[model samples]
Target: MDSPWMKRSRRALELRDGFPRLMAVLNKRKNFQTIPSEVSSST
Candidate 1:
């Protein structure tokens, strides 16, 4: 069986690895939203 500490450490590592990917997705979504709004208001 895996140790308890090992499980927690693995979870933390996974989050750390995924955080940048998550941030990038979020940033792209925000930019996509902003561009549409700016174009609509400027027209």
Candidate 2:
């Protein structure tokens, strides 16, 4: 797994910038799924 810091940095850059660069950064997690925080709290 990639470091949390690295992911945060890449996400920040993507949000700050735009277009092709953001697309490249975002593409890294194209297949990822986010478990909802509500579900975690319920568990």
Candidate 3:
């Protein structure tokens, strides 16, 4: 069985790893939406 401390640390590590990936996805989505709107407005 895993210790509580180990489990907590593992969860924290997962969050640390996942947070950036989540941010990147959100940033990419924002960029995707903005780019199309800008292109449409320009033309």
Best by TM-score: 1
lDDT of each: 0.69, 0.60, 0.69
What is candidate 2's lDDT per residue for 1-43, written digit by digit as tens? 9899998888677656665764564465454753445423632
TM-scores for the candidates:
0.49, 0.38, 0.49
- Residue 42's lDDT in candidate 1: 30
Which scores greater on TM-score, model 1 or model 2?
Answer: 1
Model 2 weakest 10-residue run by lDDT: 34-43
Model 1 ranges off by over 4 Å = 26-43
Model 1 lDDT tens row, 1-43: 9899998888778868877985676688788764445324532
- Report the lDDT tens digits of candidate 3 across residue range 1-43: 9999998899788868777885676588788764445324532
Over all chains combined, what TM-score does candidate 2 have?
0.38
Where model 2 places Cα greater than 4 Å from the true spot, the runs are: 19-43
After the best TM-score superposition of candidate 2, give how far the Cα of residue 3 lies from its true spot, in angstroms.
0.1
Candidate 1 TM-score, C-alpha based:
0.49
Determine which window of 10 residues in candidate 1 has minimal summed lDDT. Answer: 34-43
Model 1, residue 33: C-alpha shift (Å): 11
